[model samples]
Target chain A: MKAVGINGYGTIGKRVADAVSAQDDMKIVGVTKRTPNFEAKRAVELGYDIYMSAPDRENLFEEADIPVKGTINDLYDKVDVIVDCTPGGVGAKNMADYEKAGVKGIFQGGEKHDQIGRSFNSFSNFKESVGADFTRVVSCNTTGLCRTLNPIKELAGINKVRAVMVRRGADPGQVNKGPINSIVPNPPTVPSHHGPDVQTVMKGLKITTMAILVPTTLMHQHNLMVELDSSVSVDDVLDVLEKTPRVIPVEASSGLGSTAEIMEFAKDLGRPRGDLFEIAVWKESLNIVDNELFYMQAIHQESDVVPENVDAIRAMLEMETDPQKSIAKTNKNMGIIG
Target chain B: MKAVGINGYGTIGKRVADAVSAQDDMKIVGVTKRTPNFEAKRAVELGYDIYMSAPDRENLFEEADIPVKGTINDLYDKVDVIVDCTPGGVGAKNMADYEKAGVKGIFQGGEKHDQIGRSFNSFSNFKESVGADFTRVVSCNTTGLCRTLNPIKELAGINKVRAVMVRRGADPGQVNKGPINSIVPNPPTVPSHHGPDVQTVMKGLKITTMAILVPTTLMHQHNLMVELDSSVSVDDVLDVLEKTPRVIPVEASSGLGSTAEIMEFAKDLGRPRGDLFEIAVWKESLNIVDNELFYMQAIHQESDVVPENVDAIRAMLEMETDPQKSIAKTNKNMGIIG
Candidate 1:
């Protein structure tokens, strides 16, 4: 089994740690925490060997009576591949340590695309990262976009695309973040950063994106419009999306209406953490206007990329040559089924 | 001067009363209220007589010690034109009373297009409503779309259009309204009701719209993309929009970034009720991708249609023969000069 070390045990880090633990092909060696908070204690409760992210600040954990396995460097020495879930810029800073340990590094979407030189989405660009030294997972929104669009592009050949992302103001755990009573145009500009981020994985995709932060912590809703090279019926588009592994086609007729209702559905399914790893494409919202395909999908911001991260680990370590098999393994292990 | 009766003393009703009071060619005869609410008391305090909408329930006002002038019929009888601002379906129910009074009736956007048979946007269909018995002012979002698209349609013919409206969760005064922590797709459907409603006024204008309700009371932001018949540059589009009355172009560099800042700017300008009578289009967001023009504009949901209501009144009564002249007069009286 490949040994995986998760760097940073915060929102994404803890989830990645659990996802990696759930996989049969790999086991989490340890997880690092900067401070000895409740999550650090939970890591210990979950039988994870907690490492000090900042070795110099080890006293913080010691004072809180939390036992540390070792420093981050020690954890790196024991693992074959490390998923760097450290918040944005910090992962780039951890690059040298990864290089020194001679281990493959899989960075989260938060990092800049240039940091690892290769952006990854299993369905779109898995082969590009096979046995590579490092790869970066695109953000949740980009992963959500690519998962749906890449298949359609292959089927119909896209001419151009426009998407407006209604983003959650904050993650459920992020209590302090807000536009609590406002919808702020995130960049307040045309073709937001997400469009180019999708281009990083699925090269030369002609898409422009605009994002607005709404007062919600459940999920980000993407209203996507694509002009295709050929005409398509609503069923033709639905057939393609329904067959895609990680894209779940939900129907309003099923009484699953909004993101709120979808979240409740996830909880009803007994999903761990009530996390929805798949992009919930409202089947009712999917429609075809001539050669254009339009639909709105909800991306659970915290969990959509969790499965992608697992598949990336498989790609970087050459654990699975077939992306479909790797995706099946990750989804099955995470209890994601149609 | 034409005498006007506002047949609902609620959000839109009160704002229309103030706007009409400011106009040179109209006078507020009275306003109707269903109960002895604070707004009814405030209307009397402001020196405008209050009429009981349900005359049989006049005891409700008497018990609350608020005097009622007469029944809604009494107010309708004294007015030459009545602006029906009752909530949604209620306005349609008030239609027969208007017909019996032998007065021209103006309806708010909430009422269905078939209720009046003619929809009015001072810019797009002003002439259509001139000397007509009744005209319905389009909703705030539709009004915002028409104000910008109508000018662009006139300058460089529009081929097709798509818009995503990030709507506010509630009007600020709507204390109990919510989506408090969720971004609910208002309809979760393609080509929402706003698109068809726009066609009611700007006929044959091909457009598809999608909307989501965010947690905000300030304004609704629309991200619009239009395929024009001819190639146009950013400057070409901006020039047309800048020349359009009641569409104000705002720049991010000028420290007006989002709807929150724009609303604050309105208050800073000492606009009555901090109302923004114009659609604030982000000048920086106006860009052209070949034959397509893309931009985002903010619609102050409370008051963007206030000026439209005033101009619709002019069109139905032939108070101003020219649409531009009526628009200019309405904007000037409401202090909406650039």
Candidate 2:
């Protein structure tokens, strides 16, 4: 079994731990938390091997209810791979530590693209991350765009892509955080930071993005209009989307439920919480008159990055010859049938 | 027989004239145009009783290949009902002339809500305009919103309705209109003029709207987020929309087509474009957690409003008493049978 260590135990981290535990070939050997929170206490009760008391401390495992001694250096020897689910810049700070420890590491979405050796999107750039010791799973917005845009680019070849993303303020579970009413434009500028990140994942694709932050703690909705190099019919577009793996086309009758609804649908469809790409298309919105302009909406964010992180780990480990097959095998091992 | 006169033989006007002529109770008595346009010549060649020249003082018959004699004043006396298909604001300007001629008139979507005594929406507000002598059909945006909102309001009682309408720059056949690549916020402001027009038609319902102008001339898409008074499930919302009289639920297997595809689907389903409400729902967008917020996109303007305008005229004439029965009769008369 491949021993895995999780360096943070927050919402995404806990879910990642659960997902990793569900994998047949992976075992959760250790989990570290900065403070003794409810989830951390629970992780301790479950009997992990090497539990560090703090993320930054070199030697501190004594804070646990049951006293144990271990240094950060000790954790490096315990697990073959470590997943750093720390906030944005923090992952880069610890990258040198992970490299010196000689363990493969997974970075979260908050980390900037340049911070890691490779940016990962399982469906699009899984092969690029092969044999890289450190990889960054892209932010949710980029992940959602890549999943939808990849198929369209493969079939239609986009000339110029324009997008307007309506993002939520917070998670439904986050308290004192959100439930915003106004639709505030993100960056208040035409090309947002999020847009360039999407470009990073889809190199050579000329794309522009705008975003509006709405008051909701669910999934973000991206209104994407693509000017393709060639013209295609709506039927042709739908055929391409249907054939693209990891994209879940929400039928008009199905009624796009909510972020929770999408997540639940993903679970029902056997996709991990963030592995879903729920596209709710308005047929009329697909203006194929000249067949060059194609319009659609893509939903994405944090939860989706988890699956990419898993695929990145498998690719970096070179567990299988074909990266896609390895990713597929990992998905099956994690019980993600979709 | 009611003598139907068509003033302004444009695309919609010509279709209206053709549709009315097909009815046994309606006859094409007179058709008018500003100049001896091709359609005017065609109308004269079709052998109607009189061909009245539009705004121009000269008689069109004298100028035509087939010698005839009539002015605008002559047409006023010859036809019982004059359908004003002139450009915006022009309909209201000519309304008094038609009324003075003792002719009941039908106005297209160009006239503002305040310009007419009564506004008509075939599915939602047709009964309100019944027996009214001069009725203006609500704009395509209002018609689209009413079709989707009215049913939900009737079934679920909305608390607040927030909408973002992405409108097409020009109707099909309009000239020098669109760059087709740019998306500008319509009116470049929130609570656009179109919003109040929609509110005026939806009197007694509380709603707010935003508008964006896109390059496509096909159809307008209204992204609506509605807060219902009570909690509801996605299934419940879908059930209500599917069972609603005029709303046609686009099936999943149909794939995402254009407004034209959806309109064709409505036609195939035997629903007249005017009374037909083609709804592509995002059930997950319906945040029923508190069972309050519901998000959906409604297709409007362009072809969707054409059938509604027809039904509005039928309703104004009091041709049928029961609204549902009238819609059915109108659909049958239009030969929109599946």
TM-score of chain B of each: 0.97, 0.84
Q: Model 1, residue B328: displacement in angstroms?
A: 1.3
| Model 2 CA deviation exceeding 4 Å by range | A45-50, A53-71, A257-287, A293-295, A298-300, B1-338
When candidate 2 is compared with the true two-chain complex, its DockQ is: 0.02
Residue-level lDDT tens digits of model 1 in A227-329: 9998778888889988998899997778777788899999999998898888999887887887788899999989888899999999988898899999999
Q: For each candidate, what is the lDDT?
A: 0.89, 0.64
**Per-residue accuracy of model 1 over B219-334 as CA lDDT, tens digit each:** 99999999999777889888888888888999877888778889999999899899998999999888787788889999999998998889888888888879889988888888
**lDDT tens per residue, model 2, A1-338:** 78788877776777778777877767787777776556766776766644553545433344446433364566778787888887678888889999888998988778888878578887777778788888888887888888778888888788866566666656656678632222333443335677688766788777766555554565676666576877677778877766655565554235432344455566676654444533434333444534444444435454666666666767777754465676566556665433
Which predicted model would earn the best DockQ? Answer: 1
Structural similarity to truth (TM-score) of each candidate: 0.98, 0.52
* iRMSD values, candidates in order: 1.3, 17.3
Candidate 2 lDDT at B150 equals 83
